[model samples]
Target chain A: MSTLNLTAKAREAATSGDYSELISLVPYAKMIGIECIKLGDELVFRLPAQDGNIGNPTLPAIHGGVIAGFMEHAAQLHLIAAMGGQHLPKIIDFSIDYLRAGLYRDTYAQCQVWRQGRRVANVAINAWQTGQAEPIATARAHFKVD
Target chain B: MSETTIRPRAERFLSVLKHCQNLGMTVEQADSQGLILRLPYSDSIVGDPETGVVHGGAITSLMDTTCGISTVCVLPEFEICPTLDLRIDYMHPAAPGKAIYGFAECYRVTPNVIFTRGVAYQDDRDNPIAHVVGTFMRMGKVTQSEALTKAVNEGRA
Candidate 1:
């Protein structure tokens, strides 16, 4: 019963049921809430914190796994939206950069889609504790597009 | 249980990770301010590859987990926090057949949020393979024991 279950558990929750293949084979991207986000694309997603509110003492900061999960979900959602629900893109490479510290406050990630080339899509996403201007972390991802 | 008992944190996130065995991540050290974690080579996965080396997700998970642990170490009680976002930069591929280690430091800790940075390196330790930064959100707090036991009765996301 450890507190650090977000990365893996989120993996389970997102990739559970039928997403095992994509999650297991693709080390780069992870699953989030039944959606799979390519780790390498710039994407945005929002979900209720399992804990309900913002940061508190029981768990002092944001969970790392939760962040990863969010990126994966956001990327997928962005791709789906771009495709008009036509195809699924797989994550090829992704990167993240932490810019500032965030309090366990109501948070969301707003993603910026930079470019999409044949067979690949490039994306950038920002995680904000407050808004896009106050992003604490940023992510870039590449996905294989059909 | 009180109303606050929800989304509990792992009593020993690293220790639990050790039990995973498959992920191949290890917690080398931990304290209030920071943590050191390692990713051992899996028989199927090599560290030094011609393409650069170990998988990137492995490094991300290691960095992310340690950041979460570093946040938990400073907490007075246990709360289930979620990683709002993460950023990682891969300088080069790590060498296979070697251990990869990460050093994570928490820059801030509030009741609801945590911010952190981590660097991953090969055996030399000085030369890093990747640099990582992320934010963890403590959504709510709960008793550790209760959290472990609750799995039997409830379904959570």
Candidate 2:
């Protein structure tokens, strides 16, 4: 398939909210069990509680790295979804702050594109397990999007 | 303090962490210098199938785990330290089919927090795939989970 045709199809998949097709392109996201769902006009990503994703079995907390990875991927996917798959994002840098322990539960994340120029895009992501007001983690990522 | 003593403890620590186990991480070295961890390349970790490159998140996980554990080298006793904040810069994508190594050192340890800096590289430490600086909050000494402890004991037996 031509690269153009492939991107067109990916754009279609994203625009129509065929999240599985979009997610299948990245294997790590699938391996870690990330899913995307649309509520109203916003997209929300979820990481369901899994034994293999735990870090401290004592508190039964989700791994900090897992939380970071999830937020980062969520931001990337959101960027793709937002741009209608016109551009692929390569992460330049990412900074994340952990506000609270991510307990072992279904985690949800939402991303907003803070700014997007021609070559770079900045995204802010927030992840929460129980309540959105009390976020477990918040992150900012810069992606080179051409 | 001693490699012989800390090696087994580190190995046992890695085995119980489900995420570390899932990523197939192994301790290459653990001593006063810091911690060096190996993340074996696998299909499950491939981020871009087109280029056969590993995901950035996998690198983040490896560095995070390495930095978090580096606290053990500085502290007198085991404590439950959680990541406070972390910043990672992706210099480049790791080569496909090559295992990535993460080396982290606890540079500063305050009463309330531990500071760390690390690099993820393949083959050459001079050329890093990514670099990370992180801070972790120092919680009190670990309290073993009964269920996890039982599982570990049963597996050993």
Candidate 3:
């Protein structure tokens, strides 16, 4: 992809559903320590707790920005994997609703591609900390997949 | 608010956010218009290696932080406000090696919610890299930490 220069290894990982190499390709993803695991055909994104990700030390809550960032990347990576490594999508816009304060703990996210057309793709992302039923944040992102 | 009061308050307020410090953001200006915060370019935040463009997530972080804190400028007193929701549009990738600035203004402050809108620009305010509109829930007055209170008093002195 012109947007992201994916190496052979990265491409292979993309097809094999091994996202470690793909995650490392983006510096910010690595900086935030994002990890992915494939559960049956679904991918679940994980963000391990780190001190740098905290927003309010008083509540010890995860920064709302960090939660947004993590959700956005998860959606991007999920889109990449879903498209079979065809191309890297550029985010056009994102709308996120913070359901609850993201606590300072390991967080998880799952993305679902609502629709994909020739030029664009829409993704819905949900992030949770303690349980899947209680999402900390939910977001919809539009990406330019051209 | 006067620059003298807004400056330290902004600095103090930002200092409490650990992620803001991690991103290397600083309060550039705070006035009636709103809060202008800067996010410096860094390799650690780069999204595309080939182009060296900082990640959209970093820009999102800057805008979220900017909009969240902008409520202080409109409110009668400082209150703990949490982001209820945010919408961001990335116009384009920011130019590498240049800092990005977020200017956010709380346009409306209701009894329970505050609305804010802003843009992330580089050198020219007209050409923004991104635009954002966000809402936050007022959580009542903030319970200042002992250290923060002490720091504010010392800063004032």
Candidate 4:
């Protein structure tokens, strides 16, 4: 498999954001193997199999908490990129739209910074199965960048 | 004659669901889309005093487990299936005193891929507490006989 292009510094910056800290309080993402990569204006992440968000006999069906965890991750990555600094400005709120289902195998997320402001940056993201066209979900988040 | 086959992983899963059912979790519906697991709001489970509503984590557990079951229904041979991703939107706070049910459905099913979506509602689907979508990894399953054999060796079923 080709390696995904992202810097360790950018990733570390994202993993250390306040949004990441707040949600990590829950065990959902850690259990699912969620990972994020920041590339300039773009942010990518993987939703790994196995999580506490939800349980199922088939295993492909995941819980909502897992998704929320990634959303926060992507948002923070953008915050870090926009600020070009260690500390994230702030996150006012985040929201998502559920477009479809993702198999337990693995799903990918692509996030774009729509508007970056000194104080607030708006971000939009689309998540879907690796090989499919239709997005599993779309999300937009607002954050404050110092 | 061959020895009896049993799937310890599946059996162990059932015990967990049975506990939820005993607590009044209604994971009793299945349709063409997939399994529809429900969790009803009741006083015993809703320990929070302020709203008397079911806990978010408990509801998440229901969604997670049902998503897995939805995958299991399609592939009856896998020993395990894990979650890939899940997205849930809390449209409204859960009502503490009312019996709210979360209906989970698996939408996409492949040999190694599974997808599902579900929602939480108060009896009727017209009103819902949350919208949930999930992705699962079809880990793999073992047949009943294989399960029994594994149990014989592993000492835990």
Best by lDDT: 3
Clashes of 3: 0
Q: Which candidate do you rate higher for DockQ, 1 or 4?
A: 1
TM-score, chain B only, every model?
0.74, 0.88, 0.89, 0.69
Model 3 residue A138 lDDT score: 99
Among incorrect, acceptable, medium and high, the docking class of model 1 is: incorrect
Provide the overall lDDT of each model, using Cα atoms, as 2-decimal numbers.
0.55, 0.86, 0.87, 0.55
Ranking by TM-score: 3, 2, 1, 4
- Candidate 1, residues B52-115, lDDT tens digits: the string is 2455545666677766666655666555555666677667677766788888787888767888
For each candidate in turn, the TM-score is: 0.51, 0.92, 0.93, 0.45
lDDT of model 2, residue B68: 84
Q: Tell me the spans in candidate 4 whose CA falls farther than 4 Å from its real position.
A: A1-146, B1-12, B17-23, B42-48, B76-79, B142-157
Interface RMSD, all models, one decimal each? 12.4, 3.0, 2.8, 13.8
List candidate 1 segments past 4 Å from native: A1-113, A116-121, A124-139, A142-146, B1-11, B17-20, B43-52, B143-145, B149-157
User: For candidate 4, lDDT tens digit of each residue in B1-157?
Assistant: 1112223333345444323444355545554445555566554444223345454545555666666555544554434555565555666667655666666666777777678887777767767777777777654535523543344335453
* Cα lDDT of model 4 by residue, A73-108, tens digit: 556655665555455333444555556655565778
User: Per-residue CA lDDT of candidate 3, range B1-157, in tens?
Assistant: 5545666666777888888899999999987679999999999999888788999889999999999878768765556788999999988889999999999999988899999999999988888999999999987655644444444335431
Instruction: Output the chain A TM-score of model 4.
Output: 0.68
Question: Which CAPRI category fits model 3?
Answer: medium
The fnat scores of all predictions, in order, read: 0.12, 0.77, 0.83, 0.04
Locate the minimum summed-lDDT window of 10 residues in model 1 chain A: A25-34
